[model samples]
Target: MTMTVRDLRPEVRADVEGFARVRRLALPFYLVTADSLAYDATHAHPDSHYRPLVAEADGEVIGTAQVGLVHDSPDPGQGYLNVYVHPEHTGRGAGSGLVRAAEEYLAAKGATRLYAWVLDRPGDRAFAERHGYRASRSAHFLRLDLAGGELPPLQDPPPGVELRPGTDFADDPRPFFELDSETMSDEPSDIDYEFTDYEAWLESTWKHPLFSPELTTIALVDGRPAAFSAARTDGGTRYGTVMTGTARDFRGRGLAKLAKNDSLHRARAAGLTEAFTGNDAGNGPMIAINKWFGYEICATEMRYVRELG
Candidate 1:
């Protein structure tokens, strides 16, 4: 009847699978798999000090945590620890144990501030507050039925614009990196990130296990990348758009909408059944865009911050 938390061993298939299972049960909005988990554990930047942990009760995994430092942020000594306990196994000390272990690991690495995402529910919020964390911004997880619901009709690109899949840049993905960095910098966030290292981006984002270049749609204006909708698949029927944005000069032209629509259409044609995406609560434009595509808000999570002592 005792629950204990330990570091997740990426080499062990069962350990990685268990961790992914717990996360999927707790947060269905995210796409997690054993391969993705193992890739992250092995390919993480050394400076970030990434570590995955699992909470076991009677030799069964019931909780998981992804703990790491935000090394890419301009600010120093900031870290993150997102913990999730399986819904069926709550109130068994797994959640608290995972958080405590994650905090201890982060604090030992000189982290001065820690951030976490908690489900927007009374009990979840109470747990964070009791652990000395204060709620900050919020984000919504949206779901679209690719198999059963109607999608926005695909529209042809206007004059001087062309639509292409992300695979077009298979020889080189620098353009997509530039586009991603520009749009990501403008996103409303508590931490400002600088995506200056192209090599790092290539190693982390472009080559990720879940990245689906063929399914990602890009809008080009005069042969220049103007807008893009990046897609990631769970190696199953679930497809998620990780990022979709238009270049600064291309905003308000409906190019982003066009790109996302094309991507969704492609995903559905490829046999994907569900589509998922997330938007910050304060991002009115993106939220409105997603709503226009028939996406519904399925869940919300509030960001929590705590100062390490």
Candidate 2:
């Protein structure tokens, strides 16, 4: 009945595997894999002070915490620590221990405000409330059946608009970075984020292990990056659209939908079976687009916040 919390050791295969397993059981709507777990441990932004943790009982990893600062936010002192305990391991002290450890870690790193995502369930909500966390914003995890559901038939882009794979920009992703930065600046969110550093984006996102250049689709307007659908996969059947957005000038032109549909078609043709994505609960436009694509709301999670004293 002994329990303790420690830093996640990504180099240790068992540790990453156990962490991935726990996440899959607790949050199946999103993508999680051993390779992703290990990659983040090594490639996360250094300034974020990322310190993933795990709570172990009897030498078995039962809970995990993804702790880090809001490195991209212009406002400093913002941090996040998302904790999850294995579904079967709940009721033990693992969840609480991990939360305590995560809070202390972020505080030491100068985090004054903290955010965490808790699933929208009675027990999960109650757990956050007990920890002094206040529910703020909510988001939905959606799933589409790439193997069976009828995806929208691909459509030809309008005059001056062309659809292309992300691989076209493999030689130089600065254009994509510029477009992403613009769309990201105004996405529905509780915190303000600015992707000012191109190098940081290259390290943290463009070259991420799960990003699939071949499956990602971009909508170009007269050879300029206008909208894009970023896809990530585990080199398997499970695919996820991490981001789909149109530049400010093209927001109402249906480019996001065009790019996203192209990506979905590519994923299905590539043998991907399931597609997943998430949208802020208040983001009606994006939610509508997902619904149009036959994505069902698989789960919902609320953003829980607490100010550190």
Candidate 3:
């Protein structure tokens, strides 16, 4: 049996479904769907040269890789290739082939530094190291039983602040976009990102298939968005918090906590049973907040970096 790596054909539903299946099997903590896969492939910035590659064995996609440059980052030459192979296909050379093809593609596009997330398993770590990648920072995948766990009682907003759903801003979401951009600028990461592209954000985030605007909670200060907890659902009982943050000026006022609590309560009321989220290992404030909400660390993955000459 031979495995060959090739560009993913988004037009082919089977290819996208197979790629998403491998990702779901390898990383169950995160959300992945056919629509999301196609969106990422189609809506990616052209400057990034984003390419989703799949390893095919006997006409079946056994492994997948999302390869692209960090176009939104302030720094250049940074690229990423997140590779996932079906657990059943692990012993084969599919994973290696996918990574090699991804690296070559990014290198040809002028990427000097590459990063990938490797699950914190021994074999996964060893594979990354064998390819000259060194582990940098780590992050955890957290899960909460929204249906059974006890969540903090929802609280009314303080004076001058009011809680609203993301859908409330449907007529004009620029305010939320501004708030998101400000909060995201401070997120900890190896790559520096600037969310100055509002149009792109609208198409990619606000209009995403999984984004649950009705379930997302937003805190408004004098009718302006000050903090928010974005929610995404898989059109089923599974829900996830994609982002929860407060504006810089609104920090320390517990607005973020207030927003998240409201969102979670709404999720439970809407019949969602499971909730998931992720946090960088060093983000103490968010970690503390999640822990306070009874979310348990389910799994961890390490970010590995490699340099190409």
Candidate 4:
């Protein structure tokens, strides 16, 4: 079987569909659609140097790679290549071929440090180690059976606070952006990210194909955006919360929880039966909140880093 790696051709519907299929098989927790795949390929920031690669074996895509520089990171020369091979095609050299192509591409573009997320399974960890990558922080993918599980009953907002759908800020999302920027700054991450480009955020995040403004919930304190739970959907029944955070001044008031609960209920009512989310292992507060909402640890991934000359 001849296997080759090449850049994903978004024009070819089959290529995009194959890439999404491979990703879904490898990372079931993620919601991947052909439209989202094409959007990333076409709309990525120029500074990101993003390239989506696919490994094809006899006209079938068996693996995929999302490779790019971290344009938002304060540190330069940092890049990432997240490669995933279909479970049924694991031993066909697809994973290695995709990684090699990604590494060569990023290296030529002046990337000196590379990072990847490998599943917490032993084989996946060994694969990264064999490639000279060392494990760093870990994160977990959590799942909540919205259809069968009992969610915490919704309650009226506390005095001076109101719950609103993210769509309420459609006319002027700047307030939400301000809240997002502040919360993101405090997020636990290996790289420090600064969100100073409002237009960029609007183009990339606000207009993203997967972002669901109607399902997203926001908490307001006397009309001031205090916390939010951002929701994303694949145009299907699957729903996920990509981010849930509270403003610095609004912490410890359970506003974050309030927003997330509202969002979850909205998602369930919208016919989404499964809910997915991710959390850094060190994010104790968010993890506890997820647990309280009946989310269980479904899968784990370890961050791996490698350096290049």
| TM-score for each predicted model, relative to the true structure | 0.98, 0.99, 0.98, 0.99
Per-residue lDDT tens digits for candidate 4, residues 1-309, read 899999999989999999999889889999889999998899998999999999999999999999999998788999999999989989778888888899999999999999999999999999999888999999999999999999999999999999999899999999999999899889898878888889878878899999999999999999899999999999988999999999999999999999999999989999999999999999999999999999999999999999996
The runs of at least 3 residues in candidate 2 whose Cα sits more than 4 Å from the true structure, single-residue gaps closed, are none
Per-residue accuracy of model 3 over 42-135 as CA lDDT, tens digit each: 8887888999999999999999999999888889999999999999999799888988999998999989999999999999999999989999
RMSDs, each prediction?
0.9, 0.8, 0.9, 0.8
Q: Write the per-residue lDDT of candidate 2 for residues 189-284, one digit (tens) a residue.
A: 889998899998998788988999899998999999999999999887999999999998887999999999999998998999999999999999
Tell me how far the alpha carbon of residue 170 in candidate 4 is from the true structure, in angstroms, after superposition.
1.2
lDDT for position 197 in model 4: 81
**Backbone clashes (count) for model 4:** 0
- Return the TM-score for candidate 1, rounded to 2 decimals: 0.98
Q: Clash totals for all models, in order?
A: 0, 0, 0, 0
lDDT of each: 0.94, 0.94, 0.93, 0.94
| Residue pair clashes in candidate 2 | none
